[model samples]
Target: MEFSVMLELLFSGLLFTLEIFVVTLVGALPLGVPVALARMSKHKWLAWIARIYISVMRGTPLMLQLMAIMFGPYYLFHLNMGPDWKYWACGIGFIINYAAYFAEIYRSGLQSIARGQHEAAEVLGYTRAQAFTRIVLPQVVKRVLPAIGNEVITLVKDTSLAFVLGIMEMFSQAKALAASQVSMVPYAIAALIYWVFNFIVEMALTRVEKQLAYYHD
Candidate 1:
């Protein structure tokens, strides 16, 4: 393959990774916070439900989830799922699966906020909700950014799993190209794409982390 052709194929592969990563984060961020709260709830039933969700998502291999989401509709109901539906199913599955993990990370960060802080808020006559919104959440965000950044980077890598569902993501594109080229050049090019994209993401998240560090309590 020509150098230009290799670059084109590599770019397409990376784009798929980008799509999955962006969609996953969009779904996970707000959803993960709620999940974290649910898992931390004083209500036993609520906590149990949250724990079960997290357990199932974390316990099962993500690929299995993908297989189910991709095929479950037609098999169960004979619904003629469209291409958009497939992406949505995969997106939902990825978001739910990763959100469980992100929730745990957020919960740990929330725990790192001192017990006295909540006590102090209560002493000040702040409602629990007020205390959480006004004080605890900001601190948790600062504490968890590094870990969250780690997950975001990992998500960039995990996008390859989309290929299992026949999504023409970057790795899938590369595999197709590799077969046509009858060589590993396509795979090598794909690796370079991942490296470059992640390096850029790492740098950007590092800057954001530094900017938010001043808020660390």
Candidate 2:
């Protein structure tokens, strides 16, 4: 392929990669809140279940998780997945894996909060839900933004793991092209794209951090 043709092909794959990244974040971030709350629940059973879940998700390699999600259904239950299951499995795998990490970050932030804050909210006649939404949640978000940013940066690179499902994400596209053309140029281009992607993410997160800086209590 000509250089321009190669770049265009890779760009097309980058779009698929972006879709995975966005879907994972959109699903995982809010999903993590509940997981974090469950992990910290006063009910022992609920906490134990949540703890085991987080442990398993964090302990396993994400590539293996993707493979399991993609094939386990058919292998274990004899239920056939359609062709589109590739995208579905990738999204689920990424969301669940990232949610585990985000949940821990959230747990740390929630625990770092002072007990006095919750008590004060209650004394002020705020309901538990109201206090959490209005007062506690804001502080937790501010505290956890940097940690979340780190995970998000890692997620950008991890998106390449989608290739295991035969999804032609950026890395997969580059690999195929490099093999056919017998040139390392495609891989070099892919690396440049990835670096640019991470740089943009870092800049965006830095801006968000600055915006939340005023919330220091």
Model 2 TM-score (2 dp): 0.96
Instruction: Report backbone clashes per prediction.
Output: 1, 0
| Residue lDDT tens for model 1, 67-171 | 898889999999989878878877988999999999999999998999999999999999999999989988888898889988888888888999888888888
TM-score of each: 0.91, 0.96
| Cα error, candidate 1, residue 118 (Å) | 2.3
Worst 10 residues of 2 by lDDT: 208-217
Give lDDT tens digits, candidate 2, residues 106-207. Answer: 999999999999999999999999999999988888999989999999999999999999999999999999999999999999999999999999999999
Error of 1 at 153 (Å): 1.2
Model 2 misplaced stretches (Cα beyond 4 Å) = none
* Native RMSD of candidate 2 (Å): 1.2
How many residue pairs in model 1 have overlapping backbones?
1
